[model samples]
Target: MFLHLGGSTVISLKGVIGIFDYSLTKTNHVNNYFNNGKKIIKICEDDEFKSFIITNKEIYLSPIAANTLKKRINSQNFTEKVNILQEHPTFK
Candidate 1:
């Protein structure tokens, strides 16, 4: 499953697992809207921005990539990273 978190970035939940065990359990108890599976691709950390691009189905930023994306997000530069991803083609 994919989600659009307002910006141009995207998140893919397929086969992905939650970082915290409690979150996983809590999420599983909720009424799933997508019914895609037991996975969460979208997350928001304190003091950080979160966004997604549903069309591409990829997670753009997390705490791991926050440092790199901070300046870009501040400048509203989204497509540059997407373009870089397309050009390099790393993970699925």
Candidate 2:
């Protein structure tokens, strides 16, 4: 499954490591680390991101809230489980 961060930015959930709240990255160490990295991708145009999505390839600044992103992940997992269950020989 894929997660729409913002704008035209969409990433695969399989590569995602963690989703962190924006405020959590406000510390000097966190801010400096992310800001200095060239691999950091900001999804929104402005500095109004709500969360940080750390993936295998790069770090993404998403406009969506952390809680909301977690919910999306859970929803995807639930859908996959449902599909698996339906495909089981016992269910058929």
Candidate 3:
């Protein structure tokens, strides 16, 4: 599973730790954490900040909303449940 983080940055969903909405929080700590140029991958086409994804590898600044990203991630679970149901004799 891969999540498209706006630009050409598509990362493995398995590696993602969390998806956060930038608008909801006023955490200067998080902003400070991204300082020093560790690697802030900007995927937002507009200057507007949307959400951010934290991974084991890097932090991503995405144009997609947190809710949207969450849906994408949870879609994996929905697919798995559908597959399980399909495999059951009762479902068949």
Better of 1 and 3 by TM-score: 3
Could you arrange the candidates by lDDT from highest to lowest? Answer: 2, 3, 1
Model 3 misplacement above 4 A: 78-92
lDDT (Cα, tens digit) per residue for candidate 3, span 1-92: 77777768788776676677765334555656667466667776546668877777787878877777767767666333111110223212
- RMSD per candidate (Å) reads 13.6, 11.7, 11.5
Best by lDDT: 2
Q: Which candidate number maximizes TM-score?
A: 2
Q: Can you give the TM-score per candidate against the true fold?
A: 0.21, 0.71, 0.69
| Model 1 CA lDDT for position 52 | 21
Candidate 1 local lDDT, 1-92, one digit each (tens): 34233335344433222212112222432224224442334445533533222222322333333233334443553332332121111221
Q: What is the lDDT of residue 29 in candidate 3?
A: 56
lDDT of 2: 0.70
Candidate 3: RMSD to truth: 11.5
Q: Please state the error at residue 87 of candidate 3 in Å.
A: 39
